[model samples]
Target: MDIRDLLLELARTYDEGKGTSSGVHAQDLLRRAGEEWRHLLPAGFDAEGNGGSGGASRTPWIGVYDPDITRDPKKGLYLAYIFAADLSTVTLTLQQGVTSLQAKLGEGEKRRRYLQSRAKQLRAGLAKDLVEGWDARPDFKCDVLRARSYEAGSVAARTYDTAAMPTEISLREDLWHMAEVLQHAAAVERNLRDEMASSGLPVTKRVEGEEEEHAGLDGFRPKDGSDYYVLIRQRKIKKSRSHEVLVRLFGEYIEERGFVPITKKMHPKDIVLRRDGVEWMVEAKTVKRGNPTKAVREALGQLYEYSHFLYEEQGKGEPFLLALFTEDIKAYAPYLEKRGIASVWKTVEGWAGSPMAVAWGMVDEQ
Candidate 1:
């Protein structure tokens, strides 16, 4: 069934009374809806729906989970579609898990307060622009305790009134948007954990919403044109160990070639090579799973920004732009070349570069 049809069906047929024909029908619709939602997701994601147990639930929902984030709704983050207790509205939300929180604080008003506070932090850590259209503070108007907790746990949401239900395309778009937000959150959490581990810092329980602590970024503050500023404001928050290593290794390679590589603390670009009045602004990114496209894209943006602000804005001639990666970004090589930016990546034999880089003597043809 179409998403709107499924939602409308559940809203109209959902019976408050237990064991009623309509109640059974609602449960079946929810199950089928879950399967349909599951088909819309990518390989690593799974969708499931809960229409209530024994009796109809006050707020039925279909949740999408990434195992890398958390399978259970008791902890970690996920995207879900929750119908109001009265079924007057359905909300698509990126929400936190609250069951574990209640387990710690016990049920009552204290738990409710903590849930909202945690939700605030979750919202704070993510870039506001990423989920721009969603409401940061949404009221689900649920009567039951569990449903109320879900409302308090919401990070961001978009509510649709049943009377003015959304089109199928709109519903799918919202679902995909929330999915991207969840993916971005998982990457941030992963980077934070990696940063902590590399520094020998104990990885604290992330389930409790304490994941924003930046132990690895101690003594580091944001500065315009610096990595810290770009990372924090642009949602590239933490630098992984591999990223650091790649930069260091590339610097050494440049030094051996009789060029001076400016440290990041002294400059905005990852590695700025200088010798004989020539400068090459090199931005390095470590590719994960051999997919260098995301890294390449980020490097491209940073490269242009740093070049404009640090050099051109000050009347300095535009520096040679180079996009460096941990793996081959060959697919983007021609694209970068068209824009007069060179491409380079790590290889088993040594460093490899695009034709422009080769002609510029950044690396020999290989």
Candidate 2:
């Protein structure tokens, strides 16, 4: 297996693949990733998660998780391979933090001790070439978060320099590191007070929908999700499964029409759409129950920027807004139209295409 080849495939196919023409959907991602690594990954440990805005990002990555251990990476460590925009480089990371960790490992000295011991051991090994030459320290990677409401705290990480090592070294370390790094983390997850996670090993089945909170993120928000835009950009976290699902569904809609999607082509829009000499962009936002208004409203601004900055200014394509919802948001349709953008949502009647969609000539089917 060529490391460069893998990086190319990750950056290209995952970042801008065939199914991605319409947009990258969750199933497309899962299928693509599951196929790519099923041969390499452990039976229960699947490589998943379409990183950063789903369509693509400067730092797009796919996370490998042992579902039996803990799906939420913040609670425990998951292997993540991140690719650069050009697909010319990559970074293999250990997904870690307090919320996801607490969900699996719980709180107090014992948990901290284990993490520190493992962290120290990793540091010690890297020093002696037990692992490849890489900066394995929290000091360099920690981001000092600004949460005015709470005490200022930090999250650190060491940026991976993909150019530093021989191909064999990076490839060998990736496999070796994945198997070794999370074994202890997975084993001790049973110590968590949550009954479902009390068993320290993989399970015969999987459960859906666990209520988790990001205290760090919420601290900066004004309870009404008012500071959503300000706080969201500052969040350096993993993509939600729901977001992936929405992308997948939207991707399907695009594929059926045989339209190819150019993802993250413009920074503001998640994916750019084109057909019949009519080109446009769509910025998708998943609806969070309490913050539907905020999510849709912010999406309007993002769509406008993608169009105005990347299209209109440069004499290019049109821009549109997409709000993915598991429930009805027809009431917000007029709001989107008022902003001069098309609104899209799901319904029992199939995709709820707003009047703006027909008016803008974006969805030919509409």
Candidate 3:
């Protein structure tokens, strides 16, 4: 059968059963798919008693799940093709089931490093082979199972819609163009394996009943508010004159000039400065990477919320909400400015920008 016939058959499965799957229907669909494109499919189907979904109550869609490796439900992989009821659309999905298991490899700094590096690698690989109309989810529901899905993993999916019945040539071209999305998902799995091998951290076998750690940054939000502080405690920032060192430098810059600066005294903020009849709340974030993307975003949130907490203690005065980034983030300056927050970008030598940018009249008054 050609691509057109496969599409028609998928539609028939959905139309006939209306998303209610039985063992017989599942076996039949698997047989048809295996017969159609056995050469192009990935591994794990060659073994004795290859696996397929028995049946599912999949509303609005009829689907087949072919597990290449299902020995470990949390760490294997699958290729899925499900057609919607209308016969006008179908979705192809590829996912790595072990992603959540990998993300929780270690407890602290080591895990953070692994997650950050792995995120970068997966993002790069997906972008490298991504196709049109396909949207990439970098975190892809790692540990959390959404109500819509059956398992957790890295997933890249896209839908193809045919306004009318597609001709053989049209279906073939359509399949070829969309095949890259599955390849993209497969590439993500490969990148993750590379990340794991190169990490060199001591691998600990997971204990049963262990909870999975969700990768921060879905998965964009930074995990721990105390991470930068943990670096401070470990003295890892002392030997290296990195962005993290700027936290103490900038805090001293405030205090040495007669402003009283306190660390963690304010709620949800790294530092708070008080003097001259005004309070200046600051969130200090440092990154060792090229761009302080997640750090800066998290800092903005902390500083904004800290301002409110300070207001509860004090009053609704035009106090300063400041964000200090160790990297050059002039592009993000406008965003911080719009929120009336003054931003300071630190260079290896020193810093720039003053809280007076908010026009609070405190600069001259002080």
Candidate 4:
């Protein structure tokens, strides 16, 4: 049966008026279903708790099901169980600690004394539970299975003897299940964050790049031959310092476009595209990822700097294009537009075409 069907059946069996089965609600039924069919679920948190400001801290707990059961063909047989924690118990623990701490602090500055005493008691209680709980429960055999320990944020693996069960499961299989669970949880968290943001909650924004307006040059003939000189200067600097991959890509693109691409290794200005005695200076930048990191900002700034040099030194009166090549356009497009920087946001498919290019026009002084 499908997951939904199986869940419904479990819920019906556990319904209030059901026979010997406990009258658990649908949600609880679903939570315990993983344990009932432990052989079919992935491993992870059995219970997750998110606390509100007024309540106590809830510790998340997870259940691991035996992976040897082969009853279900669709989902194998192993499933890890998860359930939500009760908030009342968490609140009580917090209240108890607070009361004890306050009473001790009132008599003297016994902060360390109170903390040490409380910790000792807590550890003792946990140890007592571990010894008694495992020993008393026949179903909880330590020989076949071991409880996994977690350090800080890292999870240690719990392994069970597959040969002990009817089916032979491996440690690798258990690890794979654990990894899957973590990945799924992460996706869920991201979805929750997106939902919260969409619900008009205040979100933090991290701005990494300078916010400045830039303009591209339009058709305007330079009075002097200084524009050519500046272009030469910037090109030289760019060729010397730019990545080899970028340099090769730029050269190939220029050649394919049938434009004379000149590289000056001195104090160069812009990448000049000359055709039919007309020149279009393009300030180019290569963006690998979409996120606006320092490197991305620096590349953009370099592009703008080259544009400035072209307008001031070169006699080319055409609009300068701030051509950017990147796989991720959504993240960087708005920022580029906000800064009044003309950009070409392109994927692999559109990079060879001019339609993907966006140009921010510059004002010409008459």
Summed backbone clashes in each candidate are: 0, 16, 2, 35
lDDT score, residue 164, model 3? 59
Q: Write the per-residue lDDT of candidate 1 for residues 283-333, one digit (tens) a residue.
A: 887665345677778888888877776777557899999888765777799
Q: Write the per-residue lDDT of candidate 2 for residues 1-366, one digit (tens) a residue.
A: 234345554544554433333345532553466456543443234566454434434445566675544576455556656555554555565545444344544454434544544454333422243334443432222121211100111111223444554464456445444544454333333333322335452222212334444353345443323244344445554545545555556666665665666664233245666766656566666554223676676677667654554556556555445544433456787777777767766432345567877555434454
Candidate 2 lDDT at 121 equals 36
* lDDT of residue 239 for candidate 1: 59
lDDT of 4 at 63: 30
Cα TM-score of candidate 4: 0.29
Better-scoring candidate (TM-score), 3 or 4:
3
lDDT tens digits, residues 180-231, model 4?
3333222222222111245333232222333332233333344445654443
On lDDT, the candidate that comes out on top is 1
Models ranked on TM-score: 1, 2, 3, 4
lDDT of each: 0.71, 0.48, 0.46, 0.33
RMSD of model 1 against the true structure = 15.9
**TM-scores for candidates 1 onward, in order:** 0.53, 0.36, 0.33, 0.29
lDDT of 3 by residue, 299-346 (tens): 777666545544543456746787776555666777778877777654
Pairs of residues at least 3 apart in sequence or in different chains that clash in candidate 3: 217-220, 217-221
